[model samples]
Target: ERLGEREGIASLPRPAGRLVWVHAASVGETMSALPVIRLLAGQGPVLLTTGTVTSARLAAERLPERAVHQFVPLDVPGWTRRFLDHWRPDAAVFLESEIWPNLLAACDARGIRRFLVNGRLSAASTRNWRRAPGTARTLLGGFAAIHAQS
Candidate 1:
């Protein structure tokens, strides 16, 4: 079933109109993005991507009619490029701390407007990021706007 789900992602048809890609790494993120997905679907087609099969199932059940769910590809450069090229999303909205360097770089190179919603960094994670400040900046800078919660 998982393999079938992943394969289906590659076969998804491009949206007829504008496509907005929303990525949530797992079930919690998927649930949190539901309302936003619905709102975006009203404006244009929404492609919601989640990394977990459980989340995919939940998304399939709950997403609005105009929204479609897909499994997020692995964070390999080629795969990310392929996914982006196929989806051609007008904008990319990512939930929480699901930042993938290769994916963000691909999106940035494509000039896709990127947003980070409900972002939160743990104290330990912040300390870890501080150890690699350049990497942190490079990744976080990709987001046009970040709505973080304390």
Candidate 2:
């Protein structure tokens, strides 16, 4: 399943009308994102992408009716483009500290509304990103807004 899905390949067709894309990298993040995913599903179909098999299984068992789970495309520029081209999400909402440069750039280039929810960064991560300040700014600055939690 992962082999086929990794390079932006998906088995399911994108749903019609407004689609919101939410990505959470693992079980913990997925757990944190559930309520937000539920809220967004009320508005439109939500495509929730997770990176691990365990998380995908968890999402399958737990996700709401209007929410669909898929493995996130690998963070390659071409792969990201393929995923975005197929889905064409009206908006992209990402959880926690994930900072996928290629994926964010792809979304930005396509003019998709992007948001970061429960945004957080460890001191080490902050230091790492600070090392490449301009790259961090360009990727994160593209977000329409960021919703950080306590």
Leading candidate by TM-score:
2
lDDT tens readout by residue for model 1, 1-150: 445334334656887888999999999999999999999998989999998989988998999988998898888788888888888999999998988898899999999999999999889889999999999999998899999986
**Candidate 2 residues 8-111, lDDT tens each?**
98778998889999999999999998999999888889999999999999998999988998889888998888888888999999998888999999898889
TM-score, candidate 2, is 0.95
Q: If candidate 1 were superposed on the true structure by all CA atoms, what would the RMSD be?
A: 1.8
Instruction: Identify the runs in model 2 with alpha carbons over 4 angstroms from their true place.
Output: none
What candidate 1 gets wrong by more than 4 Å, as runs, is: 1-9
TM-score of every model versus the real structure: 0.93, 0.95
- Give the CA lDDT, 0 to 100, for residue 130 in model 1: 95
Candidate 1 has an lDDT of 0.88
